[model samples]
Target chain A: MSTGYHVAVVGATGAVGTKMIEMLERTTLPISKMTLLASKRSAGKTLVFNNQSIVIEELTADSFEGVDIALFSAGGGISKVYAPEAVKRGAVVIDNTSHFRMDPEVPLVVPEVNAHALAQHKGIIANPNCSTIQMMVALEPIRQKVGLKRLIVSTYQAVSGAGAKALAELAQESADLLAGKQPEELSPAILPAGSDKKHYPIAFNALPQIDVFAEDDYTYEEWKMINETKKIMEDDTIQVAATCVRIPVFSGHSESVYIETAEHADVAAVKQWINDAPGAVLEDDPSQQIYPQALNSVGKTETFVGRIRKDLDVANGLHLWVVSDNLLKGAAWNSVQIAEALHQQGLVHV
Target chain B: MSTGYHVAVVGATGAVGTKMIEMLERTTLPISKMTLLASKRSAGKTLVFNNQSIVIEELTADSFEGVDIALFSAGGGISKVYAPEAVKRGAVVIDNTSHFRMDPEVPLVVPEVNAHALAQHKGIIANPNCSTIQMMVALEPIRQKVGLKRLIVSTYQAVSGAGAKALAELAQESADLLAGKQPEELSPAILPAGSDKKHYPIAFNALPQIDVFAEDDYTYEEWKMINETKKIMEDDTIQVAATCVRIPVFSGHSESVYIETAEHADVAAVKQWINDAPGAVLEDDPSQQIYPQALNSVGKTETFVGRIRKDLDVANGLHLWVVSDNLLKGAAWNSVQIAEALHQQGLVHV
Candidate 1:
């Protein structure tokens, strides 16, 4: 290879992995070599990058040979199996699964909030959960300006976060529903949680559960938000609570976020902090009927925040509406951002 | 009139008004005569009540001459103009519009929570806003069991709350979107808030604004939740904050509700309280993947409560998912229930 580093994208055919390729194409990171990897099912499939056709290679123990970086998004099982293998082959793995996120040695990083944590990476850097990633980008400004005391968020998540299959399911189910098919008559093979035994129709409906139940009856998605926020912000003292709900939207995730800051900041100052923050766009003029909307946030890389107001009762409490494209900023763009950060910090070379 | 009340339903052709007619048909209150009233534009229409086709009459100041109970739901403007006229014409008004909900003279009643307030109504008993009514039914039991200190709720409201025309707008916009039309290409006349200057599509997306902005940058819908909760519970000391959102759901309104109780209560006690509460159904079974889903709650009169869990940090903090049919329990049924309470309390006479 030339002076640039080699990069491999596992799960190259999946939803987020597809966007990861697009992000890689647009990213300024120098790449003399690119490797597209996936499971055996997608091994022979070809995807385009830089106007060149690239054949997908099956991920294996030796697939990371000479690779400077490997971005993994296949699933937790695949990540648990192949991530360490990739790392052993001298590739820094940026894992996009829940498998290694909570590992004490694994640095869960959102470059906007915790890029410095990349220095502590021991070959594996866990990308924070999609919901947590966007939230970190939106709230890090507030956390930096005024110490965050507590956070309570209710998410209006889209089906894309579940994967490409969930997106197809939403499309098919919605088509079936609009054709006058009874909801009970339609079969939903995947939704809410694919690993879970049950499936529900997500077209024109809201599922209060995202992933399987974890400790204290919270879903793994909720726990991911709660724990990942702490890990990313690097402050376990900030109490976080989350209710993750899957709405019918296909791409963007919207959140109704409530926060209690350690210090009092007026709405104007808070807006200014968000306006000044990178990767965050303020869309909050109520007089002009301007606010962050799910449809408007689609295809956008920035986190859109609006409806910022102080709590009528609590002096330090505030509320905001946050929206972002789950596939872009929440998953693919974030992983690529980490890779860019790794490159900028000279941590990409193994 | 034959030992029964003569009931008049204003806005008889509306989504809630149609449900009100259905509710009256099933109500325990004896209605000897039913008068259907609407605007002059809908005056020539006919609606069936109790298997009888009733001719719709244009609502005027003289429409409630002999009516003992007048249910006003056309709009806030109409209610402001006609509710007092109905009451002056010897009728007890149960207004479903927000025109008089916060009036000190008009008692805001969610019958299950504050039916006793009906006895003090000065010829006008106000039904709380659609979003507020369901929340009251779910939380009143908890408030009674362990005093509520503070509540923060984020609502996933339905399109029908905007009325019949908004429902039509959603259907058309959804069909156009499904046919591969761009979001901007579709003409959306009503949504988010019709009276507001701008409109947004509600098909497969979420809008953070539910109504016009009010004081402190809160939407009028959010303020309705905050102010009406205290009014209906008759506890001005209970601190409430709300973020109201309009989602793609057709009927049911779902909320992510978090509350801090005055005293400690475990999950089991909270579940038991919800299970025992009138008009509240407990659907929370985490292992079974059961929660209050919007689609499943459609057309249901009772508010479904689920996803009940304690906060990981705060001892007294609790969270719940509450869903209800916005047209039924949230509007018509709640108003009819209030009428029943007034009848049972011997307060229906002029």
Candidate 2:
């Protein structure tokens, strides 16, 4: 535990990977060396760390040879191909993709919610969905105080979560629209789902679909939140439904979550629990018009919870608004937190 | 009923008023004459109606002297001050403001959901909130097939609903942000809520508060939706909860609505009812990726309902995605529809 560890960050040129490096720089984990891996297109690119320029390498099977911890965030395909190779090379791969999330052997980890589940991971731990991660940060504290029975969430997700290209698309499309050009004439190559054949403008419009549509008409993004929350909470009995939407926001993801607890929980008590929890901030002062704003949560690693109130008609129902930087707490910071937890428990091997 | 009518469009220079004029041209109502009325500042402006230019006149107590039906799209203050005067001058005011919506004398109408409510109006008929109108169009059909018990909605509203200045602010601030300038440096004079001291950029963000804050910490926009839904349905006991958010969308309003019906209902039955409803267009075939989108419904008057599905856990619970042009069906068209209803029923006096 005292020795320095070797870490490798996959997708180093991407949004979440860049934040992972930043989070690592502020962490107490003694990093002996850091390796940046990306596609061949981005290989040989230089990124600064500790005042020195380190070149990103093209990822391959041998990339994880001496790495103790590997954070994979390229995409589901890359993770499916390289994660096993990383694991075989003795690195504990923490995948930030949906590829291995539902694989029973892979434990979906949201450190605040289910860090203990990390002990059961077989060389690879899966990061929960961005929308799910933020909700878990806000709900776990309350769930611990009073059990959760049912949940409904509607997310206002950001384009940056789709990657750098989508963010650029929004900027360009917005500029074109303001210039009086037809929005349709402006090519949409990045969103609402990049891999989906047709793209829609995200500049001043909301795309209700996030990720690809799955069976039962639920998008993969919504299914991730539903399934990941259950796996992270280890409660298959909890009823969960999600409507994940892509808004024009560039960074933070905001959610309006309604929950019915097993026990009737008072708003004040739940607010107190959220305030007392680590990595959770309470911004629910209605009198002062204080509530979480996506604009304010950018670059931050904590989940901002606000607008906590009991339902007027349903005795056990409570509603809350949760906001957090999807690239940070929802991805990079959460991945780094898992590595930290694993290191503290002496679970990582070189 | 067969004869042409003399229609007066109050607040003719405003957002909804302008749209009302456009809708009237496309509507089945035969207009013998069209009068455009506005405040002193907007007087002398010319608007074309049916290939003829009509000069805008300053609205006064005597403005409605020869008007058969007056469609009001002015603010609540102007509606309160001038609606009675218009009624006294032999015109029936179809008001698109909240000033008279909850009044015992004024019937809150969504033409599709409660056109019959218009028959109860003495002299003025009130239009429901933009968010409520869209939801009611999607849900009333379900309510008819299977009685509605509770409704929970979270809205992704557009900036145009706030007025022209707010839309301009959003555009200006967006341009500032693209130039790498701070949003605060742009000086937001109107947004989130115009009367509120603080304003946030809606360029790429979602503001949870739409109107001014009301009792129970809900925004006035949220309260208006809740109260207006009950009054329009004439069911005080039906539970409704709303979370209204202002997104960067310019025109269309989108909502994620969850409902519980008194009787057990399947997705197919619900879809059929919505498809057959007067103003509702079902866009919900999930397999082909056919679903309601805000961009598609921007200038359209139809309320698009899609993603209708039964909840996995609750037998009576259903989820729907509703979208409509906030200025059209939610305001202008509804106002004009009331005018048409009034003229047909002999409620208007020329």
Candidate 3:
């Protein structure tokens, strides 16, 4: 491993950004110095990392100067404008936004699924969406062994994916609800999608729409999962449908994924394959009441899979319950993992 | 319509039973006497209906002696034991339990989807599962126009489906979590599946398993949806898959349903048919950000349908968001609707 690499994290004050710092402290990357960068609003705020209080600097194009690796998580707009600048400054950008994920030159990667795709990136290695990342980690093993033909997934996503304010909204709404206030009275400021016209409370309910409705009536989040799965897996023949719903959970995202494999396999063999898969932990044991749950997956990096069931009617159909921390495996840890992969492959510097 | 006929409501104090009593008050069924029956523990307790306070009677085979219509919302075991007695006592029993749902002699009826099935009932009509009832109401109209070939559904079910005690647990757990207690410290008393060995808090989390695990790793709740949909539609060739999950919402059950039709149809045509369907209200308008929601579906009997989008890849595949009050359309209202259908068809006396 390379020693004394300077790392900068954009959007250091946000939910995923803070998690990025937390994950960085625990990461194996040999870092001599770490700089936190966020918007002008969060400048001068200090966050603790490795027991040292580091002051957050205002993010600008100049923030990438002397930085060996830059991890971006502010949002798509910030990444779209600053990612290329960071790359030009000789810092390999591991962007956590959707800005350049679909770019032909950029690699949208989940480290466990397509780390090899990292080799060809032009400085930017995009982290897949939080919901998509966990699913990719859980399903890629199956995809490699049996081949995937179709996917139907419904996500029970956390509000924290929207950022710190959305997490606050859930807490506020819960307090209001417990105080006997009407649900309609609790205005949701940042949920489902911040840009969407209508806001629905996520304290004790499920919002079916996530991100915004794109062309063909699917939300951008749903489309991201469908498109990113194919791009990361490098397969387009897989028919994918996703319902991205935001629930009241604070951190972890749980998905009920049903897949139809291209090749048929026995249930016992599939279970064995999952048990042996990397970065995937099988927690399914019906007799022992072991199953992957969002409450249990919080703050964990490994994708937890349980409730594996063979379909009753379809011969090749399989069901899996996958759960992971949206901030960890979904975004921050994934972004840092890409940086680790870059350093391991001797490709950190542009 | 029948006038001055005796009506018996079993399981009067239960969640669905409470809603059943509420629905009966607004129903068109003319009643001379209304008898409330529950366990012997709740006997002698008085409940008010039509401004008359009637004492609750213990459930017994003789309780249905002169009853013209009997509504049962107790567990399957109780229904299995007492529903037959009600039928033998000359009451047209509308069982809101799973005991008779698959019985060859019984007609599984969703009044909006298959009211005609009631014509051949052998003195007992079976109400479909709460999750199944809402989806059937939303999709049967489209199924009539363009036949359905396959279905994949993931349910965001409410805690009330587990009964009033489970609802209480959700509220209690939420309070504990917001008060800064640990998740594991907040002991889950009843949720996800009450009869299961372990319980998980549903306050800010989702449980993938609703009922106990059944054949092929599918929960009994999921299997009911698969089997009930086929039996209610009277088609054995259609393929169905279900993942029943319990969310924190108290009453409404929301479902993300993906369907493949036998014939290709335009989105506008499908929306038009849904607007015209009985017991199904179209609330879909992406432009105005209007869609069905669990919080908004409370106390509503009609299944709310929205987010109707045709698949971008498949020619005949369609996706829909279906929501309804599980206590209303799911249990009490469906049972009462079956009773109304029997009266309308002059079969109330069996």
Candidate 4:
């Protein structure tokens, strides 16, 4: 009677919950029942998945009893308390966190840019922001073929997107600054963030803070890349701006965006609409010294644009260099590509 | 009897010619006779400076006889073959080499944004790109308290701006990827652009190619930060755009930038015009996470500026981070502050 569906993940020993259990074991999610949950200090920890190891259990509020599809990457205070107790146990949740991403009834999805707002999910959705879901999958095929109207990113982030103790404090402050120590003699406590109260030395360094000083002084990871890029490009009058930082990368996430195209968009039709969009790749070719690279986009779930060009003075300006994989397409392969777009839109029922 | 101006340096043991012999031994000029030069395999090496050692020698065509100011950081093919043989033997060169920075009779200079374009020098002046001399000393005090319009930068450069063997190949490919080795079993060669024919691994990576694929596909360090910020702010209609990446920092460079003022410039008067500008340095205080980082602007020669804000949507936009020390204010303390502003504007003659 194992006819798939009944899945869950909720921070199963994180770093984007072990890449959402290795993207639900190579997705096409049929799952039948996995459950892993966490905290209570990663409960009896086990975690394998497909070949089944599982264990981890401790999350409460009845840990989504008969879950149909959960996910939630465990922090936005455990998805603002168990993502409504895994949507009051009917499950659907998705949520990677930035607390229900600008919650207008949540739905900040990015299944390659708004998977039809996941059927207007009332059981929560939100996952944008691993630098705004790789700049909305490298700018939703140039905002659906030239009409973006303004943007300006700058990231280059990575230190495993600030998790797993910021990748063990960037490998113990890069082996204590290559063994000669002194970044004020080591002991960093974790990233330009880990509850930001001042903790620097992102080994070899460059941390124009990532997520603390909000409002006018940006960085709540630059207002979640300027408000989850206007709610996943649903267009809040299209203008945006960001500046993230946090270098000494350990797992891809390189931006440097910059857009603005209400019309006239050429660089070969925006590199043939980012090589015909959908999860973007087009690692452009500046004559063979190809482009897009942050340790070659880590475990890549694709979003690797390249130094596209145009913009010598804003005639519909441009310029890219995207890159991806900050814990798989910036957080558990975009929450298992939004649970494979809600099990291919039947919106999962279990 | 030695009275004060003979100087020289040329490529005196590289890395911005040993920081222009440690900025001609703590600058207030008055050198009298130093010399050095290099390349004939670092001609008999030696170095030291004030505590006296010297030696170097070889760069011939008669090494500038009565040298008066010289400087020139080796390579732009040894400053197009010995900077006009040290400017026809009388020597006033300066050069740092982007091969006579846009030579419409070369002026370029950035002594805190055009030390009066060094009284229009003909005897070779030019220094500018070390990421465009710390972004023309952090945007020439907000382009003179707000009258500039449109600009966009990105850079985060450093791998010792591809020198000192790209900082010993990013400290031997970051101790060969922390001793496990794999960026394709490492052997990077140089960097994103060490004469660009492919050489990656900027350790722990991020290399949106700098310096080598000019025009349309950008990168010649993004058209030297878009044509040396329009020739050191002698404004060619002030609209620019750049990207230039290369990370794994070994010496500061950072940038981010983005500007657009011709008026309404707030953010505490752009942090009090970059804290009353003259070589810039305001390290913004987003509630004391104090911005401008890049290993705290290594060996700082000013140009710090912090994350001044605004532009949540244009209204004369703004946003800066800028940092410096791309070998001291981007290349031997801006070529020893343009030979201390050509020895305080008397345009240095011997």
Candidate 5:
């Protein structure tokens, strides 16, 4: 029998944090103790799990005293401050922030793609960006079969990736739009880029910018896809470019990924490889009009891939559509999966 | 003094045909007489153009006998049968169908990109695909400056391009969804491909397949973008690829275009080209958080360009976001532009 261990849930009141609790309930890892941690503002809130009410405690450096593992998802700053403290207190940290993803010591883990990287983790395992995690699950199988040379991805991301308030913003904005309110006067508080001074409505339109713009005019979200893919795959030679856009949907994230394989690839073989790959479900059937769609993918842990096609001009080029529930496979469940992998592989001890 | 041309509008009752009438009212084309023609089923339908209700007459071979210019937005079958008859009767046919776009005898024109090609037209001028027209308006200036070598475009197209009923379907489906209905149960009668057996919902979703799958899994809409870009730009050497997707918006179409310039290109120079180019507007301003948005382009006749950035990997590659009212610059205005061009060049006589 697997040993039951003490666990701490950081940022328990936020969006991904709540999902982390939901995922932890469904996880295979045996838990003897659960500590719900949040900012002081949400400290007194109670959340129910497994027919028990867990009163949230304000997160502090001392909160991880008896914790075996801690899941962090509040924000980068919270992770940067409390993650190491949780680690120094003898708990393994599975971070869902961009904080330590590129750090040499923290293994950026996607259980299906690079669970092996978990063995080298030094008390901290980093969960990648939501967009990167889904793409990794869909493409890692193909990358193993036919060596990858280049990747070009464009995303149709949902508003839920922004946060819970952003979700409320979209809901309110959409209701306003339906009730004859102008899109301009919708009073958007958080969208396109949350930290930026201005915000745009995500109702009935598309925003080509996501997160803040970074170097070379690429958004930080796009950069995360580029940088995290290289780090997680452990191959920096691969050419990756991305254009991430925000759409009006609430949950699932969809991607249009184009890749140039080193070897000449066949669609039939690619489809077979995807079907057999772990965490990937091939939903492509042009005749029956069966394909992966965003709304159809919500609430699922596995990534749904479809619309596979070969480029006419480029001999070895291939295109695929990928969709997944960003909150689950992209963030919370991914962090929980890493903790589970650490337990499954005997990489962590309470 | 400029002379007015006797103009004939085929498919007077369709979505694009109605827009053509509205555009003609605000057009520079010196139209002396207007004849509204449609399929027999719509013959008696009355449409108001220039504050006058003109009954749509049944389209026939003799409909264009006294016309100097015939703007055709009818299906390709009607254009194929009547366009030749219209041409033989001394009328220049500006077809918005794919029938004559690839013909060696026809000039596929996006006036801002290649008005000179009109001089060699054999009485037929094909208005390039809707998606292609907007991209051309955005990119032609950049192409002229640095010379384009490659293009990869992914579109977020509105439902209006599918037809009037498709627009109604979107509105109805969205209303149903807002009323807390299941998205899967929403009946979709027209989408991705109208003629194809299956239809999918466009309310709060994105359909990657547009215009049915063709050779190598590319949709015919995608092929239209690829082929029409080459034809209208008059450059077979430029490598182009596209993934055309249908979104929930009603009218404007947005594209995320990535291009590789032949020469080393600078972002400032590229912005200048787009600003100075006729029929194109630049909206890029990262500091001010400004960019071309799809909804903002509705009912506008000019293409909006923004979010331009040089590729991090390819030294000469750049990215752009192009948006336009697909009914305006993409079809109706482009057709009217051709008629105005012919009139200004003294090729048309009232």
Candidate 6:
């Protein structure tokens, strides 16, 4: 509601960062000043906003001076280094990395699920994982009604979640494959997991692992879902498990989730709850062949939930299919939304 | 084992039928003569088996004359029409369609899971759904160790399950998209579901619905997972729910499964059970980044199980990642395995 505020976006050259700029343009929050921050390698590059050319600045500890809000998305390492520096300069930091999500002092926020938790943030707030954010939007209403006991989720993740380069790799490699090139002949340097040495082609394949491997035979991506859900839900006792997979999709993360509630739940009531929730759209009309699809969800801000049903024989079990643009709700839009919420709640100083 | 037995393969030249021929070449079942049958359109086309060219004949009432064992994979419509004809000719039919899967007289069989059910087959045996077969292969061993109470599965299925033309569409459309063509500009005559009026581009996208839409907002693919699971497990009381998704992968099907057992189970004990099973392979070493990946399981016959873990808060909940070549273990290989089982058990005769 303020006339204008100073906002700084880190990782300005990345996938989510570009979306943040777009969202900021359409936002009601008046941006009197904007700073585009990226690594030294991308410094001096210009991105146009509001018919004005803005040069990307190399982010340093001193970069956040006079900035009211800093959005960090330059991976966990960059976030760990620069997020605290931004907070020290009196900026409210909304991090889009896993570095601060599980931290006891950081408030993990999904506005629809836990906007109130944002009030307790000590300078830095954490954005939930892309797969987790979309699911939370779809399930929080049901959890409010029946009280969730357990959740099991499997994701169909897009290449864009990995970054712009990964998306390019999918497009290029796919073109190569169809042009009579062997899969092994095409060099793969950026899929399945970036840090891992070997890269498998994801153009016509599904990689079962996301992120690097972790203890207990689960990928770090799966662990992030398990740990972040507990933090966002504010319940360490809630049962959660996830299997993250990278499919050929260019945008949107789709998940198949099954939940058990504390009370016996009917599919109809749960459907009603999802349809009524903010930022959630119900597309569940199986009789007419209507449901959420990835192609239909791109560039959209709403979390689409459909295929809602109860377990055939379980007392209180329910199933849902959830999809959302990963770069939007999963990253940039969530960060911008949090900035909007903070400004509305008078939590930020201009 | 018999030295020679008259055999028939219905639905010959289809996706699964082609793989069935390859599997039979490597199988040990003795055959005096082999008969190939298909719809009238595909009839007279020659397919090679064991280096011999055999012409396909039109499937009709008399097509099963003197056949000892028959494998059917065309579709439900073909099976409902000609399966009884095969039975009337004194041949035992193993159908890979849903036509007779739920019938009281037909036995649903996964040779490794419930080969004993083959004994109750009046004349036709039902092969479980492609997605269901892979999960059962991975879970049945653990269930025998600790009884299963509930199951939730989300599948990343390949377009090849839709048939050969679908695979071509996915490849061609992907090429068209990267070449800067809009998906709508690329005509999709096949994919997602061929019978459905509308077609979706499977290139770089995920279609949440597979097969046709069924009652209760669940897809026929999802219903098949639920209904076929109970029949194969021989327990209508077990809880099951599924969301089937079609990804761009050309071959293997991957699933994220969560199960609750009747007794307390740990990840280690469950891992041991799967490692000990005949057809199940445990590839769950997260430290080395070893797990079941669709790229690695493309030409293999085994069902790969990995990412096994117990839910942090639930006493009996466990999660698993399962993948197998949908054309092989899910269909052709399982069908051929059933024939081998029948021959080994002295159930087939000329």
Highest lDDT against the true fold, candidate:
1
lDDT of 3 by residue, B84-179 (tens): 899899999999989888998899998888888888988989999999999998889989999999988989999899998998899999889989
Which residue pairs show collisions in model 2?
Answer: none
Estimate candidate 4's RMSD in Å. Answer: 19.0
Q: Which ten residues in a row are the worst by lDDT in model 4 chain B?
A: B1-10
Model 2, residue B329: distance off in Å is 0.3
Residue pairs clashing, model 3:
none
- TM-score of the first chain in candidate 2 relative to the native first chain: 0.98
Q: Fraction of true contacts kept, per model? A: 0.83, 0.55, 0.67, 0.86, 0.53, 0.84
- Predicted candidate 2 versus true structure: per-residue lDDT over A172-230, tens digit per residue: 99999989987678899889888887688888888888988988889999889888889
What's the C-alpha lDDT at position A220 in model 2? 90
RMSD values for the candidates in order, in angstroms, are 1.1, 1.6, 1.3, 19.0, 2.0, 2.0
State the lDDT at B296 in candidate 6.
Answer: 73
Off by over 4 Å in 3: none
**DockQ values per model:** 0.87, 0.67, 0.74, 0.34, 0.64, 0.72
Tens-digit lDDT string for candidate 2 (B262-316): 9998888888899899999999976666788887887798999998877877889
TM for candidate 5 is 0.96
Q: Which is better, 1 or 3, measured by lDDT?
A: 1
Question: Which candidate, 1 or 2, would have the higher DockQ against the true structure?
Answer: 1
Tens digits of per-residue lDDT, candidate 6, B127-200, equal: 88899999999999978888989888888898889998998899888888888987678888887789987788
Per-candidate Cα lDDT values, in order, are 0.91, 0.88, 0.89, 0.82, 0.88, 0.87
Local error of candidate 3 at residue A202 (angstroms): 1.3
In candidate 3, what are the lDDT values of residues A280-302, reduced to their tens digit?
A: 89998877668888888888999
Q: Clashes in model 4: which pairs?
A: A4-A32, A5-A32, A219-A222, B4-B32, B211-B221
| Residue-wise C-alpha lDDT for candidate 4, range B9-110, written one tens digit per residue | 877887878877887788887887898988788888788899998888888868888887788887888889888877888778888878889887888887
Clashes in predicted model 4:
5
Lowest-scoring 10 consecutive residues by lDDT in candidate 3 chain A? A1-10
Best by DockQ: 1
